[model samples]
Target chain A: MKVRVHVTLKDGVLDPQGKAIHRALETLGFAGVRDARQGKVIDLELACADEAGAREQVDRMCRQLLANTVIEDYTVEFV
Target chain B: MKVRVHVTLKDGVLDPQGKAIHRALETLGFAGVRDARQGKVIDLELACADEAGAREQVDRMCRQLLANTVIEDYTVEFV
Candidate 1:
């Protein structure tokens, strides 16, 4: 099974990196760009037998190590 | 307007961070875990007046700064 995990900073969190990226975009001559925020995607190859098992494992991966629950949220998509 | 960008490492790229995470998950007793890849996310509160304009701006942001096209991909979700 293949799984994709997206992890993002929760609202109200300060994103210095995002701010830097926004600045860089303006430097690149992309006008009207208001803001930019950044997040992560994790792709996984699993040995699970079924979608249900993959979902459960992916969820556990996210909660346990793929994301910091205090500051980030994650969703898993299986293929 | 609010835009969220998710950037992830392309396949075939070595992700030590993701590997470390996969190890951590195993240590945490998340069985059936095989592999993991990591990426980044950015969220923005923008002043755009329309979704069409926001979409364009967000695309520019992703192309110019939010993601490294050589090794990353990004998508924007408007809220």
Candidate 2:
């Protein structure tokens, strides 16, 4: 099974990287872009037999190592 | 309008960051994880009037700065 995890900064967090990207976009003539927030995507190939089990395992992974829960949020998707 | 861009390393490209993440997961006891790939997500709030326009503008953002076409692939989503 394949799983995808999206990790994004929490609301109100300062994202310098996102700001830099937004500025770069504007400099490139994409002025219609109002704001940009950058995040992470982790794609995993699991050897598990069940989607439920995989989700649980990946959730733990996120809480433990994949995310900084104090400043970020994560979502899991089965694909 | 909102748009999302997912940027991932192309196949056959070596991802040291992904490898380090995989190792960390294993050390944290996620043994069922067979392989892991890491990518970036750029969420954009566009000032455009139409979804079509937002998509086109964000796509150009990806090609110009959000992604490196040499060794990476990017997908844009509208939300």
Candidate 3:
């Protein structure tokens, strides 16, 4: 099964990286961009065949390593 | 309007960060992980409302600054 995880910073956290991108866009004349937040996308290929099992395993992976739960949140999807 | 841009390394390109993640997962006893790839996801808040225009502008951003087209690929979506 193929799984995708999106890990993003929690609200109210200072995001220097996102701010940098926002400023860079402004300099490049992308005026329509009001704000920007950057996040991580992890694509995993799992040997598990069962959809439920794969989802469960990927969830554990996210909680254990992929995402820093205190400052970031993650969502998983099967594709 | 909200837009999302997914920037990922092209297949066959070297991915040291991904390799590290894979190795770490294995060390943590995650045996089902066959492979892993890491990418960037940018969430943007745009002043524009038109979906088509927003998509076009984001595509330009990807081509010019957001993605390193030489070894990476990007996808744009309006949310």
State the weakest 10-residue window (summed lDDT) of model 3 chain A: A53-62
| Each candidate's DockQ | 0.57, 0.93, 0.90
- Where does model 1 exceed 4 Å of error? B1-6, B42-64, B69-79
Give the best candidate by lDDT: 3
Cα deviation at B13, candidate 2, in Å, is: 0.6
Model 2 DockQ vs. reference: 0.93
| Quality of model 3 by C-alpha lDDT | 0.92
lDDT of 3 by residue, B36-63 (tens): 9999999999999888888889998899
RMSD of each: 3.0, 0.8, 0.7
Residues B1-79, candidate 2: write the lDDT tens digits.
8888999999999998899999999998888888999999989998898877777777777788889999999998887
DockQ agreement of candidate 1 with the native complex: 0.57
Show where candidate 3 strays beyond 4 Å.
Answer: none
Per-prediction interface RMSD in Å:
2.7, 0.7, 0.6
Pairs with backbone N, CA or C atoms under 3 Å apart (clashes), candidate 1:
A37-B42, A37-B43, A38-B41, A38-B42, A39-B40, A39-B41, A39-B42, A40-B39, A40-B40, A40-B41
- For each candidate, give its TM-score against the true structure: 0.73, 0.97, 0.98
* TM-score (C-alpha) between model 2 and the true structure: 0.97
